[model samples]
Target: MSRDHQASSQHDGTAGDVVVLSQGDHTLVILYGDVDVRVSEELEHAGRFSIDAARRTVMDVRHVTMMDSVGVSFVVRLAAGLRSAGTELELQGPSRRVAELITLVGAGELARWLPELPLEADVSAEQA
Candidate 1:
């Protein structure tokens, strides 16, 4: 049987993100902007909410402008946490500079997890 349902969204009215859960073989989480300590809590909630439910999770970071070490730390920790539960986490779409920060922190090992994606406003289709 095929099942189709409308997706729901909750906005925090900050520079957080438009989280979308593409429920199929894998899940994709698209982040729109700065992911620093300020928005970590919300981002984590959205990311974990998706990753925890799927076998593979793709984190789309194409639109990320500024990502502090705190953000990086949270993401690395999230990856580690997900691994413990037998789930895979993938980070994608970081600008070259942002990617450098992630690499400088020695979290580059997670580089392979970043997926290549078209640069665009994915928010429009997030609910799909």
Candidate 2:
């Protein structure tokens, strides 16, 4: 596994974080807090890294408290790009609100939605 690449953004007194971890052919993208316009740059960077480095990408959104149009667009773009490259994109544990926004924007088909993220212990074991 490679060292993590992380970015954060804040807006309207709210904040968000984007962390990308590359593990051989897999990339884990952990997203949390408010995902909005403020974090678009970081999201873009993370997406590029994922596409370039991995055949499979898992986005963990379980900790996300909010998401807006920018966040949805990021997911859409990442999904489309990865699909074109024959890569897999998994959206793990999106909240109902986030899921609704994605569906509302016609992005539901872009990526596979999961009920939960992969086990942290499994990933940690691999690291060890």
Candidate 3:
């Protein structure tokens, strides 16, 4: 079974949303747009939900247009939290820029990188 939790924000009609989808022992966090300080709160909330729901969490970063220090912190912190709980974090479909920044910050070791997105069929099935 799967469940979804979503948080969205819009500033001056520009921003993105955080959507959490949990399936079995895996949870997928979908993030879009500028993932800077603006979405930190939503990201944190999603992180908490991920920890509470799954043993493995995957953050979907393919739709992110930009990232700032706060975004990096969120990933690092979330990874730490999950680690303490004996869970794991994975970065799914991160763009080159996002990947670079995370590596530059030395947070790359906190998570494993996946070049592909979660299965569309699974998402669609959950939606139905």
Best-fitting candidate, scored by TM-score: 3
Candidate 1: regions farther than 4 A off: 1-14, 121-128
lDDT of 2 by residue, 9-118 (tens): 43233478888887776889988789988788999999998888747899988778899889999999999988888887898888889889988998888888877645
Against the reference, the lDDT scores of all candidates come to 0.65, 0.84, 0.83
The clash count of every prediction, one per candidate, is: 0, 0, 0
Clashing pairs in 3: none
Where is model 3 poorest over a 10-residue stretch in terms of lDDT? 8-17
Pairwise TM-score winner, candidates 2 and 3: 3
lDDT of 1 at 83: 76
| Order of models, best lDDT first | 2, 3, 1
Model 3 clashes, total count: 0
| Candidates arranged by TM-score, highest first | 3, 2, 1
- Tens digits of per-residue lDDT, candidate 3, 1-128, equal 45477766443323766778887769888878888887888988998888876479989888787888988898999899899889899998888999999999999999998867556767899899
TM per candidate: 0.71, 0.81, 0.82
Listed per candidate, the RMSD to the true structure in angstroms reads 5.6, 4.8, 4.6
